[model samples]
Each structure stands twice: as C-alpha cells, then as structure tokens.
Target: MKRREFIASAAPLGLLFSLGLGDVPFANAQTAGGTPVPGGVLNVAVSPEPTLLTSAFITTMNIGQVSSKILEGLVSYDLNLQPVPALATSWSTAPDGLTVTFRLRQNVKWHDGKQFGAADVQYTLLEVWKKLHPFGRAAFANVTAVDTPDPHTVVIRLSSPAPYLINYINTYGAQILPRHLYEGKDVLTNPVNNAPVGTGPFVFKEWVKGSHVRLARNPDYWQKGQPYLDGVVFRFIPDAAARTVALEAGEIDVALGSSIPLSNLNKFQDKSRYSINLDDGRYLATIFLTQFNVRKPYFADKRVRQAFAHAIDRNALLKVVFLGYGKPATGPVPSSVVNYYAAQTRQYPYDLKKAAALLDEAGLKPGKDGKRLRIALDYDAGGGVTATRPAEFIKQSLARVGIEVELRGGDTASYLRRVFTDQDYDLMISSLHRLPDPTLGVQRLFWTRNIIKGAPWTNGSGYSNPRLDTIMEAAGREADVARRRALITEWQQIVQEDVPVLDLVEQTWVTVSTARFQKTALQGDGLFASYADAWLTPKKA
Candidate 1:
C-alpha cells in the first residue's frame, strides 16, 4: 500500500460526537483548539494498580499507560499509526537496509536532571531490550551491535535487514532508560522501577500502594509549554462499576484502558460533562483471544482445538460480553491493520454439531453425562468484567459440545504466573494489543524462540512449527513491502489452521474523558497518549 493510503486506512474510525466538533477527525480537532489553559490535575482511573512501573521488564499496556507520562521511547506512533519523532529528532536507514542511524534530541533532561544522550539509548537497546523485552528480543534478534558515533548519534548495525525494527522501537520495545541509574546495579530489581526517571513530560512524585500513583509536571521538560496539567493522579479502582461511578460523579478526569463497563457505556454518551470514543481506532490495535496450552495432551490435537473453536459463539459473545462494542475476529490480526490483514483465511463459524463431530473424530467419546472431556479455563480477573465474562460465556458454550470447563480466575500477578510461568492451565482467555505491524506484537505470541520461562505475554503455548517460523523470519527480513505482505498473509493462514491461539473478537475499546480534557491524542490505543500536548478547557463559571 502507498504511504498515504496506509495512513488513511490506519486512522481512527470517525470521532464520536461527544467532542462537539461535529464529526471532525481527532487529528484536525487538535488544531481547532483555543489557547491551552494550563494548571489542573488530570485524575485518571486505571484498574488494578500496575505491578511494575518499568516497560523494560514487562510490556503490559497498563504499565505503559502509567509509565508513558514519565518514560519515552526513541519514537512514537502518531494518530495515523505511523512512526514519528519522540526522543530522537530524526532517523534514516541505509541503502542496504542493514543499518539505521538516529540523531538524538540535544539538551533534553531526564527526570533527575541528567543529560539524555546516546549512551542511554545504547544501554536500553543492548542491555535491556535485546536481552529482556518480550517483543524486543525478536524484533532486534538480528541486530549485531549498536554504535554511538558521537554523544548525540546512534547507529544500529544488523546482521540482516529487519524491516520491522523501527516499528517495534516506536511502540513499547525501545523505552529509553537512564544508563546512570541502572548501569551497575541489578537492572530488574533496581529501586528506580518504582520511582522511574525519564525525559518525558511528567516527573515521578509518589506511588501510594493500592490507592494511586501520583506524578507532577516536569518544569524543565524539553518541549516548551507542554504537559499543560500541573500533575496526573492515576486512581486504582479495580471495580468497573466503581470506575463508572467515579467518572459519573466527576471524581476522575479520564478512564484509561476503557476501565468502565461496556454495559454502562451509554450512560455517559450524550452527557454534557463527558465525551466517549468507542471506535478503538488505529491506536488501539487489539483482539480478544482464547489461547491454548499446546503442551497439554487435550489441546495438543489440532482436531480438538478446532472443535473448541467451533464451539465459540463470537457474535453472541460480542453482544453479551462486549455489549456490541467489537467485531467478531477472524484471525490473529484485526481488520483495522489494513496493510497486511488477510481476509481470505479459513474461518470457524459457530456450530455445535460440527464441534461434536470434530471431537468424536479426534477419538474422544462422550461419557454417560454426555461430556467428552474435562479441562480448566483461566483468565485475568484484573481485566475487569470484559475478560471474566467472556471466559464464562466460553465455558457455557464449550459445555454444549460435551466439554466440561472448570473456570478459574485470579489477580494480574497470579494470572501471569499461572499462564506464562507455570503453564498450569489448559486454556486461557485474554486480550493482546495487535499493534500496527505484526512484527512488533504478533510474532512473540506464536514464535517458538520467544517461549521464555518467566516472561509475561511471550509464547506460552509451547507451539513450534518450523515452516511457520521460517515464514515469519523471512517476513521480518524482507524489506520489500509487497513481498513482506504476501509472507504475512501466508503466516496468518498457518496460524488460523494451527489453532495455537484462537482469535475471538476485535475489541472496540471505549475511552471516555470529561469535556474539560481537550486534545487527547492517544498513542496506540488509549493505553498511551500524548498527555504532554493535552490541555484542559476551563469549567463553566
């Protein structure tokens, strides 16, 4: 696809009317603003206080949402889902495509007032990203070394061309960390994880455990007169109903990650106090998934996996669980990713008879109770009703096919431990941000090499297909957009057939904010946004 076509295709669905611009696009709405009034605390509602503050260790959207205020990557995705400058002022790739050079922004200071330069970017990529980040390890697998020619320039040398490296860096893979603070210490356990220091708009002030995380504006922020709010307070309200009540009662300025229940979305739709955006746009590339542990005997058989897929009623689940806020997903990549999304792939329509036949064909016979087999299902309770309700619905649907599902739930930590670390569950229902490019987000979920023992959100399924692996690797290395897209189409076909992870629904994540907050430019979902450019409009007298 041409650059302009791709940008338009990836742009957000139309702006909701609550913004009062009469259907103007969000990007254009920013330019229609009055003078930005600075000096008010933007209270945000986030479910389940973040377990970790650093994106270097885990890539959870919740952590990124909170950390983006204080931390910054080398590049960030604009409203069109295209990589734009962030900490790096400019960057260019060599003719051979094996090298990328970045020119750093000079005079930018970390939250601790230290100079932000090449060494920090070098350390972040070499020590942290390549070795630890879930997506980074795959995206930068071919990066041979990072060279700092001067104090303000970085040149990345790769063994082979990696077409998607820049996209990964722009997303969550390359969140720059200060070399001064973590150079000699235990990077993972360093105290800076809780009290992080970065060159972003906000300064880490205090984190009151179990209540809220508070951040104050950085007076010396490199971008002049930005980060209009005096501070931002992320209130930890785990209950979806409570978050809705808070938004309704004017207790919070914005609800991050669409924490409010979908059932209650209409409550605030036309309210004069708030506006709601439910299109999910290019910024929030995500899909609800039903992942299987391929190592387990029950799910090891592709027939059984296909049977389970047929048992799911995605349209009904969309209506009941998401309250018609999403579309039935056909595969791993969402339709919003227009460039590489494969529409011709095989689809599993809801059919209990077909599901039962597949189960019987797989050598499974129903018992006296008309149940074929028993297995455990798990999901993260911290995701609020959105995740939990879908798992419940799946359980009931699977039971109809003579599969007895034992439903389980836990907080975020336990969920990560059980699924990613322990590999304790037979099935897991979860959602993952699909990202604008497949290499940045999707590969890690299925690639065998990414099956890290303790890493959260890696390939926990223990699935390994040599052909699929080769296609993925080739796709990453291919610089030609047309050839790369064709390879991606083939990869999606294999994934849909393998059933390593069953795609359920493409969520239309709803983000609601009070009318007082204006020009909220979201960065990849509402999980992260350009808060520094966000300004608050004055309240009526």
Candidate 2:
C-alpha cells in the first residue's frame, strides 16, 4: 500500500491546537490596585504548552483553548451546527455562488487598540492562500482569491462552489489575524504565538512557559458588557488525576479535555463539588483501534486485514478498556454522526473461528516451530484521556488470533515525531475527533497528499485506494451539502470495505462543571462554540 492509500483507509479520531503571543502585565481579577470591579479569574488546567501559537498552525487542545479566547473567526458555528456572525455581521453570495461578500461589524477593535477593517480580512486570506508561511495552507484550501471592496466589506472568491467551505472557515485554523503584525518573514518568529492580540472578548495578559497563561477582559470589546468574568487563567497540568484534584480543591475553576474515570464517576457525581455532564454516545465512545500498514507483506492481503479485524472481541474490550462507557464501532462513521449506520453497511463482528479461517485463507498457517504473525503496534502514552487503558486492551485482543502484538509507548514529542515524520509503525492506535462536515473529517486522515513520504502530517498506515481519492475530491467540491453527504457516505462505504483501518469505537467526552454556568455545552464537535453566549446564573453561590 502506498502512503496515500494508507491514509484513505485509516479512520480518524483526533483534535489539534495552536499558540500566538502578546503580553500586558498580569493583573489579578481581585478588585485591587484601583481597577474597578476586578472580576474573578477562572482558572483552567491545560495538558501541555502549545508548539505553534498562530491561528493557522495550532495542532493541540492546549494551544486551542488560549487561541480561541484571543482570536475571532469570520464566521462562528452555533451549538446546532449553524453559522452565525462573528467578525462578519452578514454575508451574501454572488450570482454564481462562488464569490462570497461579508460585511464586518463596525464597532470591532483589536486588543492592541487598532481598528479592524476590510484590509485585515483581505490580508489574512491573501497571506494564507499563498502558502508561503506555515499552517496557512489548510485554512483556505478552496479559496482562489480575496477582495476587500471597502473598509467593512470583504469578498472571498472560491475555486468552485465548495459545500464545506463555511464549516471549514469557522474552525480554529481560520481565526483572522492582524495583517500589520503578521506579514512576511517576521511571521516565522512572530512574538504573537507566545503573546497574541485579537478582537475577542478576552485580551492576552501573560504566559509563564510550562506554568499558566493569563487573559483579561477587553473592556471595549465589540460585544458590549460581555465576558462577565474580569479575566481567565489557564494553568498547565499534564496529569489527569492532578486536574481532577485541582477542580475539587478549587485550585481551578474549570477543567477541560480530561476525564474523570468511570469507576470514580458515581462518587464524584454524589458529591456537590461539581456537576458531571456525559453524552455517553458522544463521550465514552467507540474503542480506539489501529490502521495496519497494508504495505507490509503480513497485512498486504485483504483477507489478512479482515481476519485481524474479526479477531478482536469488542464486547470484552468495552468492559475492560472503556469500563462500559462506550460500545464497539459498527463502521468508520460513528452512529452519532448518522442514524442509519447499521450492520448492513459494515459490521466486523467478533468471531474467533472466522478470524482463524481467514488467516488460513491468507496462506498464514501456524507452523510447527510456533511461527505466527507478529506485528509491532505504536501507542502514545503521553497522558490526557485515551492513552490510559484502551491501548493495552487492543494488544490483548490481537494476541488471540496468532498475532503477537508489541505495544510501544513513548512521550508526546517522540510519539508525534515517529508517527508523522518517521513512518515507523506497523500498527498505530490513536483517537480522533469527528466533525459534522464528514468530508473535512475524513479527508484529513485519508487524503493521499497529507501523507507524502517524509512529510510531518503523513497518515502513517500507508493504506491507499484510488476509488476513495475520487470520492473525496468530488465531495469536497460539491456545492450542495445533501449531495456532498451522499458522496461522503459512499466514501465511508469504501473505507469500511478496504479494512486498512479497524475503527474500534466512538469515544464520548464528559464535561463536569457547576450548574450555575448556564448555556455551557460541550458540542458534539467538542468545542466551546457558543461560549460567548454563556452567562453565569446568580441562582447559585
């Protein structure tokens, strides 16, 4: 299997982050030093310090949390998966529907006291479209050009009537940047990644590397009298247990991206210290699995891949690895994304007999010398949520079908380097975050170009299929979403039959917070999309 073929066959379940800079003195939210109504600071514990801080290149949750607060996108997705105004108050499409014009909000002002205009909007798209800088390539992939007609009106010209462009534009990667501050080579070493300036509700305060990042309210923010909290602080805590402990001890006001173990869920729920919200379907979901390198002789045959998939006992896996929170995956696209995902579409039920049968069919028989199919699996153990136990359960399940599973664990930095840059794994097990736009979600993992040999973002499995490639490209350029979804379903069908990737389960995420924080929702996409609309209820202390 070629590198692109591997990506197309792999099922994706992951998220990313970015970082940028700006630094004003850190001021305590406490009403001291003559700052009126010094608001209470909300403390957040993050897992790691982000590598890239720019809106275009953020690849982890740690950097995303900070960037979201400091930056604003042209459009924003609401809880119901609808687009709403952000930097742009309203927009209209040209007669051909390929050109879109957006009118910016008049009162918006950057944190640095600079007035935001169409020039900034035009500059951002132009810089990102050129791909001369890092991370800008992914932000505006379908954009052909951008035009700023006036101070408050911006137009975007598309290569085609791309259906998923709206959804893609509102994501973390497309956050509008300050054109003046980030132009030319200066962006390579821009100070904004460590300290950012934006027109969001919060303004950058300070960042103590390896410790915490601080943000203060933008008094003259575009939205009047918003962001009730005077400031917010994100504290970096790599350990999940430590994050839970801090929340209970009041050391932090909110904890994101970490899970409270299922065994401890009942205990925590009974206590009033915090409220637990679990979308079991969305949070505790499909078991995490690996995409075998079809390029290898042992797994090259379709029968071998199918045999390996059938060998794993998903029923036992849910009980042991997920603690009964999630269920076995029926197909590549989770049931949460579509209601019609049924056994008829794709179901690799656990049948040891069938697995052994397929193994024999593939010409791999148990030899007298006890030689069996032995494959090394790479697993990231850098902490957070998924790495805790699922990987071990996967190893045990694969062991039953004459496959010797060697599970390798490493630090975060080393794990990413090996997976993305080195192409050094026979089997890889990593979690993915699904998006409403299946084309964007699926393409990110399966597109052949994303995994060119030696490229950092290569989808390591090296399983490729041409049919999938045609379907993905067609779906991306489709103008009608209904048609796009149909094409995506077709693409999903191809991925399921290929067996290069064995999707174990769809993981669910639980958010434990105070009930007083009304309108706080962890969207299915796992983003605080409507956070700005959230307001604290005075009904609770």
Candidate 3:
C-alpha cells in the first residue's frame, strides 16, 4: 500500500488516549491482590516490530522497550528518578567532579556465561557509547578515560565535570555491553546487536522477524531467581484494534507503550481481571514535534521556521487530536521533565496573521497560484491517531498561511532512514524523548557537534549556532546546579529565537496488564524498566 493511503485506512482511536499518562490517575498501577505465584510466560505486546534488539548504539523507544531486558546498565532509577544500584554496587564522584568510580557487582554473568566485570564497563563507555550512542556522543564527550583498577573496580575520568553524567547511567541511555564479543567486531553490525549477550534478568532466546522476539529467564541472573516469569515473549502486532483484541482474548498478557487502544481500557475495569500502569514512565518524558530541515532553501531563514511554528494551532491540536490527553508543549523541555525546564521560554500561539507577515517579510510571498512554497511532510507510517491527525492538521494549518503541503510516510525503518539517516524531508513529525535530564537527551537535538550523518534521533535539522553550542557545552560540564540551570534557561530561549524545531505537545504514554502481572513497574522507568523483579500471579486467580 502507498504511504499516503496508509493513514487514510488506519483506524483512528481518537482523543481516547490513556489516563495517568500524566493525568489524575497518576498513582503507581496496582497489582492483583494475592500471594505472587511464578512460572507462567509473561506475554508482552509491542507494536511495529523493532529493527534491532540492543540499545548499545541505538536508542529508539521501541528497541529499548525490549533490549533493556537483556542488556543491563550501571544503575537503575527509583520512583523519584534518583540513581539506584544495578550492575554497579556503589558509585562515587570526586569533590572536583571529574573522577567518578564504581564498584562492580561480582558473581554477575553475561547471558553467554562470561563473567561480567570492569573491563566490559571500560570498553562499552569508550567504544560504542562515546562514539555511536545517539545521545552518548554528546553526553559523554568529556570522558577522558575509563580506568579499570581490577575486575570489580572501574574509574571514569573526565576532562571536565559533567554534572549530568550520573543521570544517564540507566539502561536505555548507557546500556553496558560485553567487550569480549564486541572489542574487535564492527559495533554497528556486530551479530550481537541482533542477538545480544548481557547480564540482565532475561537471556536473548530468538527473534523470529515479522513475528516476535522471545527471551528466557537467566537462571544465573545477578538478581537471583527473579524475573519470576519463566520467560517473556514480546509479540509484534501492527494493528491498534487488533492489539486490543489480543488483550481481550488473552492472546497477550500485557501491552506496554500503549500498543492497545485506550478507549477499550474501560472493558478491563474489573480490578480482579486487569490493571493499568502509568506512574513509571517519568524517565522517558517525551515531546511530540515537527522539526524542519533547515538545510533546505525554503527553511533557511529563521523567520520562515518561526512562521511555521506560528501557523501551528497547538491548543486545537491538543483539544481535537490529543483530546485533553496532553498540554501544548511550550518549549523543548516538556513540563513533565522537572528541573531545568524553562516554563517562561518564548511561545508561538496560533496566529495566521503573524505567520503570513513573517513569511512575507522573509520574501516568500504568495505566487499567482496563491502558494508561497510547496513542502513535503514526512513521518513514520501507522502511528494510528497521533501521526495521522497531526500531519493533516499541520498540512491544513500551513495551507491557510499560503504554504502548500505534501504528506509523506514510510514504515519505521524507512522513515528513520529518510529523516535522520538520509535527511530527506522538508519537515518531519516524531516524538523526541527528553530523558531524565536535558543534557543527556535534549542537547543532542540542538548541539552542533551532534549533527553526525546516519545517526537516528540526533541533530537532523542542520541547525548550527556557536553561541548556543558553547552554552550547551558549559551546561553539560557545569557542576553547579544554579549555573547549569541558568545555562539551560539560556539554551531554551536561544533555540526558540532560532526556531529550528517546533515543540508540539508533551506526549501521553500508558501500559496495560492482567491483574496477574506482579512487581513489574515499581521504578521510575516503569514498563521500560528491565523487568528484573517482574513476576506473575498464578492463573487460577
């Protein structure tokens, strides 16, 4: 089927997103009441088959949703989003903030049975993460060396203090990989990315492409006899309503990342039969946006970009499309991401008159055909309501200001290739995650050095501002909270003035599971959590 026709045929779930996906039901999802019994396979539903199974070099949410189960990181986060121990038993930073050291947990074995130690930490930090991780290239740029004093001790020496460093040690941001396998292999194409070996609770079993990725529990998991389900099977179901049907018919036990249509959630209201989880996604707070390819001639001027921002009716988009599920994003930092969020950053409301004047002033006046310029809107295929409604809304909104719109869509792999790898779109709409910290997740979107070709989720806009780059560098290296906060404030203001990408709305996320699912989402990352402690209640409940 053609990409344009994909949206037309997609069944819209509309305005019925999830609650506690930043709504009033913001409490941690309650589990079924009973003595937790283990041994059943935890069937997890994931939409759009993921392209890869590891996050060592890539950080797509779909990939992380599954890969984190196999590849563990140095630390995990708490309900409060504070760093907690995982593979690293304890960690400390020098008073100067340049030297950080961690004591590795002993007796840990990679899924392949190799003893996990400091060498793996040293190699992962220096090799794949520092160079290939989409966000790590900017986040870990100051790391000068990783010193392994022994099998259990690893020291990270940085050229400058990176106050944002610790926050990124979570599995999704800096997932540690085994060096014995990747040391001499091509990290990007290493067969291990497709079939991973790690120290997490689950072992990579097999990935039957176009179908599912199965993971068996690690009997030798460092956590000890945990991840109580006998195994986990992530099923790939592309249709939205079909996922809802699977959940209803017991074909799948749980749906994380809102793969199931939320409007149907009301059917599972029997507390004994099911539960909804929303509290644990704080670590992956996200913003939906339409980013311009500033390298293009029509978007070369900042006024043209700002005009595009003004043409967006964000409030209407939230009301009509999002159905009060989220707020209009005022800046790059979503309000859900606390600290360093500049609430007072400049805002562009829906003003067609202002939009038209900005375009005219930039010398892009309407032609005899009543259009200033024609541009293609590119986005991933089959995002259900989120992608389809927003693309059409933006296209119609731009038409009002004398801009002609052409819609473009592709499957997951092709869309990422076109936008981030090929840099092929005039404007593209996708959700960008602002991880627990801005320096860890947000800087890569605007920093000049992050414009590496073929890197998914990096700076694809070709926006370069030396002043903003310097401020971001200082913000990353600044150990003082007040100083870093001030720098982030300036960074937010400058990006607005430049208008490289239009921040659309804070995204809504959700998870659904039968009441039998136990101890799955107690951490800040929630469903994205490695599920090390996740278990299941006996079927007879």
Report the lDDT tens digits of candidate 1 across residue range 120-208: 98998989989887667777888899999998999999998888777767435568899999998888899999999988899999999
Candidates in order, TM-scores: namely 0.86, 0.84, 0.86
lDDT tens per residue, model 3, 57-156: 8766678889999998998887667889999999999988899999999999988778999999999999989998866876788999999989999999
Model 3: colliding residue pairs: none
Backbone clash numbers for all candidates listed: 3, 43, 0
Per-residue CA lDDT of model 2 for 244-291, tens digit only, reads 677767686655543343444444553234554433114112335577
Taken over the whole model, the C-alpha lDDT of each candidate is: 0.76, 0.61, 0.79
lDDT of 2 at 503: 81
**Per-residue lDDT of 141 in model 2:** 66
How does model 1 fare in lDDT?
0.76
Best-to-worst lDDT order: 3, 1, 2
- What ranges in model 3 sit over 4 Å off? 1-35, 50-52, 181-195, 206-211, 262-271, 295-301, 356-374, 382-386, 410-425, 452-456
- Candidate 1 lDDT at 198 equals 86
The C-alpha stretches of model 1 lying farther than 4 A from their native spots are 1-34, 279-284, 296-298, 365-369, 381-385, 410-425, 451-456, 520-522
